[model samples]
Target: MDLQSIKDPSFLKKMNNEELEALSADVRKFLVEKLSITGGHIGPNLGVVELTIALHKEFNSPKDKILWDVGHQSYVHKILTGRAGEFDTLKKFKGLCGFPKMAESEHDVWETGHSSTSLSGAMGMAAARDLKKENNYVLPVIGDGALTGGMALEALNHIGSAKTDMIVILNDNEMSIAPNVGALHTVLGRLRTAGKYNWVKDELEYLLKRIPAVGGKVAATAERIKDSLKYLLVSGIFFEELGFTYLGPVDGHNYEELFENFRYAKKTKGPVLLHVITKKGKGYTPAETDKIGTWHGTGPYKVETGAFVKTPASAPAWSSLVSETVRRLAREDERIVAITPAMPVGSKLEGFASEFPERMYDVGIAEQHAATFAAGMATQNMKPFLAIYSTFLQRAYDQVVHDICRQNLNVFIGIDRAGLVGADGETHQGVFDIAFMRHIPNMVLMMPKDENEGQHMVNTALKYDDGPIAMRFPRGNGWGVPMDEDLKQIPIGTWDVLKEGTDAVILTFGTTIPMALEAAEILQKQGYSIKVVNARFIKPLDEKMLHELFSAKLPVLTIEEAVLQGGFGSYVLEFAHDHGYQNIIDRMGIPDHFIEHGSVERLLEEIGMTTEDTVAKLKSITPKKQKRA
Candidate 1:
């Protein structure tokens, strides 16, 4: 069958087990070929081929709600729902999204990108269905890594207590971006060894019933035997204890096994947990052999060789630059410890872990826990460098405020991928970090102009013992700038004057600095002397330097690659108002709306964060200096 012609999962109901197996092969081929060109969540999608097919066949989507927790694994779901033809434009601007989008198809019941949301979403849907007195099943497929999230655990407790009519498919591949960590992984490990307990228990029950004369006392003994079996088989017995009808250790790839378990789960009442074991990269050899999660999501790759097709690198990645700097500093400072919330690979903390395995900690997908854990270490006089992505840091906002900021602890936060992260779409963009972090008191927030400045900032952050300080960096490699022989601490609340001008001043930092420079050059050609200041420290505001600029009465324009509201620009405006400067001020940044999937350049252009826009904003404020004497 042509995978492209697939209209809906309705076709799967007509096919036998062997036919479904053939369909799975075709779907795998389609994904490998398509993702090689467009680049996407290839490993996750490939792993769920059969499982997704089984799910679609067993349940009617759009009516029977099937929520995917972390929509990266929904590529096969897309193919089954008549989206195989849209592969050419995957993850591109105005193309099929990399995650589940409700607007694309009715089959996509819930949109997702962030982890550990499906269970809660499913519970809500189930509640709605019951209120309406409707007959519909709700299924939420969650990964083993996602199951460890604080939100997911909370949802499990509520769902079990309510006995909500829903099915939870625990898709355990033993990884979430990086290899699994913490006690949950160990519990799942024991569960993996306990094979088909449901079948074994059923057989035992039938044998005991056939023995006749088993009554009262003998029946009570059978109950004890069943209770003992749960303890003997599944080490945790976690789901059963939580008031869920525990169903599996099912082989996710086997069509017959999947169908049997799906049928059983459908017949059972109350909440059911169908634990399915899968391989992260099931079909592709390179992704299958991957142990460190390089293939989790990626750029375009060579199909035959499985080699990535990337341009030659000019400098080290920002994550490597920051983590390696911390690792290098750790050699001298025994107090420096590194922590990541399950992103050892993404944050490039492997070197730090390898060097100081005792000091380094990888706390599973618990961002909230990771934040306070760092705070605890800070209280003990140990410098904890919590390396985490900007998008994920949102999960720990409460901890950041109450625990770290309120206490005024000396925790160093390495905010990785701190600007517009392209391709993964709106849910994964890092635009809101500065806006959220800047408002909190005693929080020192900054972004580096380049890799050299980044290393220096890392040194500054680790050395500072005042309060929580964060240094945000972009996703890709640095600009290959020259480095100094010795490390130095930049004074807090300072800005670098990259270009000197008298007529106007352009304050910007991080990814937007290059464009600001270009805009200034364009203005210079038009007889306008525009000053460019690297506004590295976002919070402290470099007040003394700012006063000098305001006193000179330069028409100031602030630019940042972050949310406009409560961001760097807003801070500058507030300072001017408080000082009664009356200097003509304007601001540019991400608009109030969410930015979707696209290349970084394209996104910038779309949001008018370009040299032309910057020049236009400046040109509007200062009219070419009136061709001075």
Candidate 2:
């Protein structure tokens, strides 16, 4: 099949089964070639090729609803849905998105990037269909890894009780980013090994029906026995008990088998779960064996050698600093334990995991559970350091407030990537932790100005043991600063005046500190003496120094790589208002609207967070001397 000729899913549907298989092979080859240069989600997209093909072939997409969980695996779906030509521009600024965007196509029912949301979205679509008296299938292709989430479980319980006519495709790749962890994964493992019992039950029903009058009652009795047999035969009894008719342990890679299973599910009345087994990196050897999930989503690489291109590993990332600091501290303090919600690699806790295996816990993408679990561990005299991304921590805000802060539990939250994470765009930006966490009672929210400060804060949080403490750091490398072997604890809730000037002051935190300092240097050359203060602690706000800004009667600028509303800048304004100062306050940070994809440098410039933008704004506020006429 020629690549140019097979432009859309409708083309593949017109082809016979054998021709379709050829087309899939061609498509996989195209993906491997294009992805090697473009750098996108290769492994997940590779794994879902056959499933996507079968789904598009089986259902009329625009008319029938199909929602993908997490949306990382939607690359294959995107290709079939007529977005294949855009693969060259994947994840680039103003190009194709990495995840499903509703504006991209009518076929894409939901815009998703986070995990465990598809089930609930599917239920809404299903309910809408029932309301309109429309006969259309609502299918949500949810990965087995996502089923561990509390929301997914809740949706499952509701779907079971309501008995909605919906088809759920459980794409079991036996992994999610990392080797899946927890009891839910264990249950699925047992079920996968046991295979589907649908055939055996059907055979028993056929044999009993042949027995005549007694057979009618016997079939009814078999139904009850089958309900009982579920617990005996499989561990997926939890899903079945919820009222869903269990369908398959079908081969997701097998196009014919997947199509048949999908057909069977479509014919069924109540909720049906079609469990299809697949490999994470299907058809690609390197991805198939990738255990760390590095190949899951990445930059341009060599497909032949599976060698990622040597994009100079910039300065040591802040995540690495957190990981190293935690590992060093854990070695000294036996009470310290590390926890993350399925992001050990991304959080840079691989070393900590190796050093303190028992003390380390990967809570399997359950942020709410991880926060509560950390609180529970803290209560038992164990200091649990939860390493979570700020964006994901939003999912567990209530737990952070209720279980940790309100109860005054000693849980150290290592908030990694606590600012604008470029390229992955809005859904992934970690820019709200400061605002959300600041107001919580007993919560100490602090972001470091440098890697050394980050390390010091980690030590401070561990030592304090007062209540819930959070330390946020940016996504990438710290500004080139020397490291010291000896650990020092900076006094908590204190701000550092890096440079003193008379004209005005620049107050900032985390990633924006370097930008603030650079802008100060540029302004200093223009004869405008500017002060730079590293406002490390966002919650406490360094009351004395903050009050001094008003006391000095200087014009002020607050910079942060976060939204302005209810953020660091807002806090500065509130402080000024309370102090009754009329000093001009200028806010320079991310705007209220969602930012788009680009390189970090490009994004900073685009959003006017760079030194040039700050200098321009500062010049606007700087008063020109009155004419000497």
Candidate 3:
């Protein structure tokens, strides 16, 4: 049968083991070729081909609810569910999303982009099933790295205590982006090597059966001995104690082993955990050889040579500049330390980690703990730089407010990817940081227009000892601006005027600054001179400049690459209302609705945040008298 003709996985139930293996091969080939042009989470998807096929054959999806944690590995699942024809538009604007979208198909029972959510989601489904008197199995496939998250641990406790009828597939690939860490990883490591436990259990059972004509006392003693031996030899004792029936150390790639364990798990009454071991990037050679996770997710690459298609930007990436600046300061400041929630490579902290291994902490997928951990360090007068992506930082809002902001600590937060992150889509876009962070008391938030200002902001954040300070930087390469030889501190509550004019004032910062400047130049040619100011400090607005602009009665336009509500522009409007300025004010930013997956340019255009959109907005608001002149 043709691979694309597969509408559902029901056909897999009729296929033999040999035929299943052939299908797995075809799927792997399809993934490699498709992803070669449109890049994605190739390594993860490639690794799970056989395991995904096995699961489909054994269980009915949509009805059974096979929830994939983090959803990046669901490419194979999408293929089996008749979405293979949509591969060309994967992660594109208005096209197929990278992660599992409930709107995409019925088989995608739950949507996920953030880690460690599947277990909790599965527990909810299990409880709902019982309440409705339904008997369909509730299964969640969670990775080993995601298992280290506190939420996953909490869910494990609850599900075990409830003794729910569900299946938790512990997909052990020994990675979540990078290599797994923490004590949970250690426990899993022990379980992986304890394959001899089954042999020991069988041998002990045979010995117990050999006690011929044993009476009640002898039989009881034998039973007690057998139980003790089982605990001593088996590595699943931890899970067993947690009220779950533990199964496997099964080979995820082998159909027979996977099907057998999955079938057994389906029959188990209480919660059952099936430990399956599979290799990430199982089929492709380059991805298979990856040790540090270069192939986890990537852009276009050559299939034969395994070489990435390079665009070769002239400037450094925003993450590298910020991390390197922190590394330089750490050389002089002994109290300086860095923390990341399992993103050493993505956060560009490898240099810092290499120089100060003891000072760097990768907290495994625990964002909430990482935030408070930084707060705890601040309590001791240590300067902790928490480097985290904006989207992931949402998970630590409570810690940020209750622990950091309330206590007024000096934790320097480096908010990486703080704007429209392309390709990864709406789930990963860093657009909400401004609106979320601005409301928190004692939290000083700002962004930079270029690498030079970015480095200065880094220095400013680390040096500031008053309260919690954060500097947001957009994803991708910095604007190749000239840098200062020596670092300097930027004053709090200050704004810099990039261009001077009298017709109107444009307040904007970060990625949108270039657009503002372009618009100003266009307006300049048409005799409508405009002023462009970098409103970098988001929380503590530049009261002095704002007052001057209002007093002069210059029509003002505030723009940002973030959501409109409670954002920088909204704050400006609030300030105008409170101060009784009666100034002509207009705001431009992302709308109330969620932005979808697309290129940064495409998303900006969709939201009317482009250079052309900026010019059109300025033209609409310009005075009739000024236009005639």
| Highest lDDT model number | 1
TM-score between model 1 and native: 0.97
Question: Model 2: how far is 601 from its true place, Å?
Answer: 2.1
Model 2 lowest lDDT segment of ten: 620-629
Alpha-carbon deviation at 532 in model 3, angstroms = 0.7
Say which prediction, candidate 1 or candidate 3, comes out ahead on lDDT.
Answer: 1
Per-model TM values vs. the true structure: 0.97, 0.96, 0.96
Total backbone collisions, model 3: 0
CA RMSD, predictions in order: 1.6, 2.1, 2.0
**CA displacement after TM-score superposition, residue 429 of candidate 2 (Å):** 0.5
Q: Can you write out model 3's per-residue Cα lDDT over 286-397, one digit (the tens) per residue? A: 9998998899999999999889988999999999999999999999998999999999999999999999999999999999999999999999999999999999999999
Screening candidate 3 with a backbone cut-off below 3 angstroms (N, C-alpha, C), the clashing residue pairs are none
Off by over 4 Å in 2: 1-7, 214-220, 228-236, 625-629
Cα shift from native, residue 24, model 1 (Å): 0.8
- Across residues 484-526, which tens digit of lDDT does each residue of candidate 2 receive? 7788887878999998988888888877777788988888877
**1 against 3, candidate with superior TM-score:** 1
